[model samples]
Target: MKKQRYALIIIDMQNDFVLPDSPACVAGALATVAQIQKILETCRRIKWPVIHVIREYRADGSDIEITRLPEFREKKYCVPGTAGCEIVAALKPASDEYIIVKKRFSAFMNTELDIILRRLEIENIVICGTQYPHCIRATVYDGVSYGYNVTLITDATAAQTPEIASANTRDIRDIGVECVSTFYFVNNIAVH
Candidate 1:
């Protein structure tokens, strides 16, 4: 595929999901962070658009979707006022980066992510982050639905186990998103 103006939409990279010690943190979350850092560094060097999509719930949980699962529904994980809502320091966003705090699985749902991407004229999206079955999958579908050429950096996203991760990755590919590895993406970008 030809390179276009792409936005790196990192989904749910907040402390609650990314830090290994976080209450609701998925196992192997820290490893995903390391992969994200590598992508972030390359994006910075290449001057690509980098957007961090966080899930910041309301303090009273009034704004949350009660229809979702209990793990995500009733629990107030990334409450807006709490530190768990903040992006991890390892992948701290720079001044030029875009930060979008969303309330749902799809980053474009009731969020500024779509507006930001449009303003940047970004037609391609390179998606990478935690929990492949959840936010990652949701964001990829939304990216495609919203008319962005979406690609999932397979090695840059992870869940609790390799089996689940592989299955999730396969599901994403079946939906028509190009699922490529981090090494393939970064190496090409480095030499480009």
Candidate 2:
């Protein structure tokens, strides 16, 4: 079988999740910025599709789930036209790159992500970004359900703590996803 085309899916690396001063900030989210940037540069050099998945909720909280509605309203996270919703400075998508706005954890949830990926003829999804337990894991599960090969860039995806990141990586790997560090992916790009 031939190696399938890959698209780098950077999930929820938005200002609200990554910046320390933002209300929805995950404790270690910003740590993965450089790693994401590194892998993204490699993807650009190789002409791979880069899809940036972001979370943007309505100010009225109608777009969010019942469980998260209260916190989202209180935190005012990722509201439209707000700085919190913007992609963080270092990892902003290029004008031509695909930027998918999602209301839920999985990028495929109520979004055109699957359609876009299909149109681009992508099979292997190289995923990296914030809060491994939620967004990253959800997207990975959906990617598998959609029958695409999934590679989790472990070091480039952060959680609240190192242990949390490690445990989630292990769980995702146990399910047959390729779990690797940003360095591993970058160094092996020549073969990819």
Candidate 3:
């Protein structure tokens, strides 16, 4: 595949999801942020499209339905325009990069991600994000549905458990997506 025609999507690498004290933080999520940054730097240097997706909820807890999770609704997390919803400092995106705000686990749901990718003429996607089973996996499926060659960067993503990660990786590959390590993907691109 042509690496130049691909984009790097960094999903939900936010404070509330990576920080230990945050309400919805995942374990070791922060560990992969540096790796993700390195990927972003390389992509930027090569002028590849970079898209960052973030989850945002309403502060008053009004946008979030308590019925979805009675316990979670009470917690103030990822409120729209809040600090917790902001992406981590280490992966500061450039001004020209695309920033996608998604309300649900699927980044393409009710979002212009598909349209943007189409506009960019992107045929393949390199996904690197947090919460593998949730947003990252969902996005990968969506990418395939949109006719993009999707590659999951395992080292740049994290989940609640190893089992979940392994299962998601297997599932994604089962559907024709390529699950690869960040280093391997980068090396292949370099060789290409």
Candidate 4:
């Protein structure tokens, strides 16, 4: 059998989204930090490629989406040179890991994520990170659409509420993406 090439894509784990006190905080995001850390450690140990996908918007809101423009302009977050735009310290990328800056929800949308994965010859993508309804869901869908075997670490990905997380997990699973816990993934999938 041909070996399965895997990569870990961590989406939108920036201070703006993961910090509880931040303006753009996702309620459940802070809780997933330890779980995401576990996954990150495992990936680093196993020598799998790790990609941190962060969201950034122009301070002027000129590049933000139409629906979000008003809010973004009123309360700026994820702008360059701001602490909120940086990836959370615990999950910061190592020197060799990849960091992708995305302006939109989906990491693959207008980003170098797809091409980087292709260049790495990655066939299986393990995804984790915040806000299930938007960034996480969109990236998972696009990962599948891009013809990669996508796996979601349920405990490591977050949404504003448990209901939203569960609902999105169900929808993602319905599309045939593997949804498993951090423990399960590290013990089973990542081992091989």
Top-TM-score candidate index: 4
What lDDT tens digits, residue by residue, belong to model 3 across residues 84-188? 888889997899999999877888999999999989988888998898888898899988887888888888899888888888889988998888887887788
lDDT of 4 by residue, 3-28 (tens): 98999999999999889789899999
Error of 1 at 116 (Å): 1.6
lDDT of 1 by residue, 1-192 (tens): 755677787877778887767866878677877778888899898889899888877666677767544666545688887888888889989998888888777888888888888898888899988878778888888888999988898878868889999998888898888888778889874344
Candidate 2: tens digits of C-alpha lDDT, residues 29-67: 898999999998999888899999998888999989788
Worst window of 10 by summed lDDT in candidate 3: 62-71
Assess candidate 2 and give its TM-score to the true structure: 0.96
Q: Kindly report which residue stretches of model 1 are placed more than 4 angstroms away from their true locations once superposed.
A: 1-3, 67-75, 189-192
Sliding window of 10 residues with minimal summed lDDT for model 2 = 183-192
For model 1 the local lDDT of residue 85 reads: 88
RMSD of each: 2.4, 1.2, 2.1, 0.7
> Which candidate model has the greater TM-score, 1 or 4?
4
| Preferred candidate (lDDT higher): 1 or 3 | 3
Please list the C-alpha lDDT of all candidates, in the order they appear.
0.82, 0.90, 0.84, 0.94
- Quote each prediction's TM-score: 0.90, 0.96, 0.92, 0.98
**Clashing residue pairs in candidate 1, if any?**
none
Candidate topping lDDT: 4
Query: What does the lDDT come to for candidate 3?
Result: 0.84
**What lDDT is reached at residue 98 by model 1?**
88
